[model samples]
Target: MSSPFIVVPTYHELENLPRFTEQLWTALPQARLLLVDDASGDGTPDWVKSHLLYQKQLFLLERAGKQGLGSAYVAGFSWVTAHLPTMEPCTAVVQMDADLSHNPDAIKDLLGALDAGADLVLATRYRGGVRVTNWPLRRLLLSLGAAQYVKLITGMPFSDPTGGFKAFRPEKLGELDLEQIHSDGYAFQIEVTHMAWRLGWNISEVPITFEDRAAGVSKMSTRIVREAVWRVPWMALHRRRLKPRTESAFAQKRSSS
Candidate 1:
């Protein structure tokens, strides 16, 4: 089986990149790492370019400016799909944060789920119980509340619907209409998973330990929160008429309960 392609959206994440890259490679040496940088003024692109000179599996996609998170992933995914034949073939596409909030060690479990026949595997923090570190109570509560709100609005049964750490089958990810994805921030996370869920993909969740970024500032803002608040309901209203290809274990469990 081919290795996975890891897409990480970065904005001024220089401090965390080295550690993240090292750990990720250590855990999955054969995987390719793509850093979609939004013109980070912190020499992020420069570092990537220098590494690219020697690191065969390391690739960089430098954007003109700070595009939203959703667009960054779209660009990364599109790049992977467009260049699949030329580069090392990959079986999966993984998306995660650059700020170390998404642990690299847990990547194996996410990919393992895909290897076990899951179409999409979410690295969830709320599967059995909350598993977050260094987060304030207010932020923690907001995240928990957001998960509940997304479930209520979209009827998606996955815990931690807004989590960014996820893996997708390369073909299944390419099937998504990338141009149609407009939501960003928390809404973006929900939108992608909802699309997969609607298509009846075998989505599964792997419990993970999430830690707040030890370096750099978070991009969270009032605008991101507001976008999620309104965009979620709009997504439900505009959802496609497609049904799942197969009922996921989570959905089946939820139904039985």
Candidate 2:
């Protein structure tokens, strides 16, 4: 009876967890959520175990200490692939933040994109002219600049490669070396999207209105930014060396022959 799982990476998000589950269920009642918490010492684990554990669709993975966003998702994906029995109509994995910044209502759009033959659907803030709300000018510029920089380096045309709101087909996701993804924070988002593109998944960017979190403090830090700054170029170089031979490339080569 397993189903498509939504991997939500949480860290000290006690206040947002309740509303997150509520809104998410209201939107997609049948969807399963895997809350990967990185030792949020604020009783997040206890609350989820007490209130949500009984639900057949809700699950949690508790880790010791803040183990970066990339690893949390890698763990969640591995767990789902290992433990969950794939059923009909369950073809994709979702990744989103626990904070309300990413609208729960948009989950349908993302999944719909997957159903419409998209291997990877990215909920982009820059798709339809900067669809973000409440972000200060400086932060907005940083995000936009980062996306542009990623595009220039990785040669991926995604408008929001750094965006966290995305859906991926399990088949497409399985092609990636998940354990090899070690970038933290926004860098992880970029790396995953680039990896999917390199794997030749049909990546579609859907416009989403990203709002600032209403309840919790932001997690953006100099360290995370520094990591992305250093790692993105290196990823570009690595991608150049180990370019995945996608089906399209193979078909083109055969046709030319």
Candidate 3:
């Protein structure tokens, strides 16, 4: 039996949960949705319980304070791996946004990539037909620049290295050295993926339309970007990613930005 689960981290996103539930139920009927919430003061937990659609197919985890995206995911993954052990077989553990930047339609693409034997599948906006809607030019450039820089430095073939929406093979859970991961923001994604690549896990990217959130203020800040800047190379040093990819057009972009 194949079991796939999605981990959605939320904070004051009461308005969008219904749509997320609806779309996931439509797109991947076989999967379960886990909402990792950071004690959203906007009655988020109560709302999740009240909704008929959300009540059945979804489960919620409440944290004491507002944990960043990476920490929420790590906690969710820890719970998922422990409760739903893959000792019996392969399961897909997928992560995406609660606000719908990662389209429901893209779930199939990520799953299909996993089916084709990839250890992980990334929903990449920078890969081909993927598009970014409503994002300012500066934001777009910065994001793409970060992903490209990671690739150039680490020689990663993935187009959207910083993308949040992704699927992981359950068996790969054993490979996760959680102690090595020290990211709470963008670095969270960067560190894990880089480690996966270093471990020689097969990864693939599915084109996706990256949309800015419809109802929430942008959580991303200059601190996140600056953190990525320092942490990435620091990771490179520790992980020995010094080998440059063709002189790094990505690095040039990062420096210019």
- The most accurate candidate by lDDT is 1
Write one digit per residue (lDDT tens) for candidate 1, span 188-233: 9999998888878899999999999999999988898999999989
TM-scores, each model vs. reference: 0.92, 0.90, 0.87
lDDT of 3 by residue, 1-257 (tens): 55588888898888887787788888877677788999999999998877665634577888998878888888888777665632323358899988888888788888889999998888888877549999989988898888888878767787888889989887575467765576766788888888778777898888888888887676787878888988888877787532312322222333575
* lDDT score at residue 224, model 1, on the 0-100 scale: 88
What are the runs in model 2 whose C-alpha is more than 4 Å off? 1-3, 52-55, 86-89, 241-257
lDDT of each: 0.87, 0.82, 0.78
Question: Which residue pairs does candidate 1 place in steric collision?
Answer: 200-244, 200-245
CA shift of 177, model 2, Å: 0.1
Model 1, C-alpha of 175: deviation from truth (Å): 1.1
Best by the TM-score measure: 1
Error of 1 at 64 (Å): 0.6
The local distance difference test score of model 1 is 0.87
